[model samples]
Target: MTLAVFRSFPDFPPYGGEFEDLMPHLTVARDGTPAEMRAVEREVREHVPISMLITDVQLMCGSNALTA
Candidate 1:
């Protein structure tokens, strides 16, 4: 699926071509302190093996909203 998106939008590369491989991940927090980050990690660990049904994808370019 990632490859298909990249192929479809060759001009807009993932992460602006910063990364060669794309992996499924979730950003728990940004610029968080060590203690704060650890707390979030512990909380996430409590709910291991999370699952969800993705029905739509949203693309954002800079501050512009682009729905896909």
Candidate 2:
């Protein structure tokens, strides 16, 4: 799996390398084909800058889908 890492908009407060304080980052995209990824890259390169507001965050494991 590959991660397209990006810095947060407006920036997050930095914590002097503290383990408990996680780096402020948002994973833009997960694993994808090289062609698909290149498309995204092209768009990003051509588009103007934008801000992303992240309200909620969640994490899940396992590749298979799970029912609610």
Candidate No. with top lDDT: 1
User: For all the candidates, what are their Cα RMSDs to the real structure?
Assistant: 4.1, 10.2
Off by over 4 Å in 2: 1-26, 52-68
Model 1 lDDT per residue over 1-68, tens place: 56678788899887778898788676667668899999999999998777777676555677444331
* Cα lDDT for residue 23, candidate 1: 82
Q: Per-model C-alpha lDDT, please?
A: 0.75, 0.47
Error of 1 at 56 (Å): 1.8
RMSD of model 1 against the true structure: 4.1
- Relative to the unseen true structure, what is the C-alpha lDDT of residue 52 in candidate 1, on a scale of 0 to 100? 75
Q: After superposition, how far is residue 15 of candidate 2 from its true place, in Å?
A: 9.0
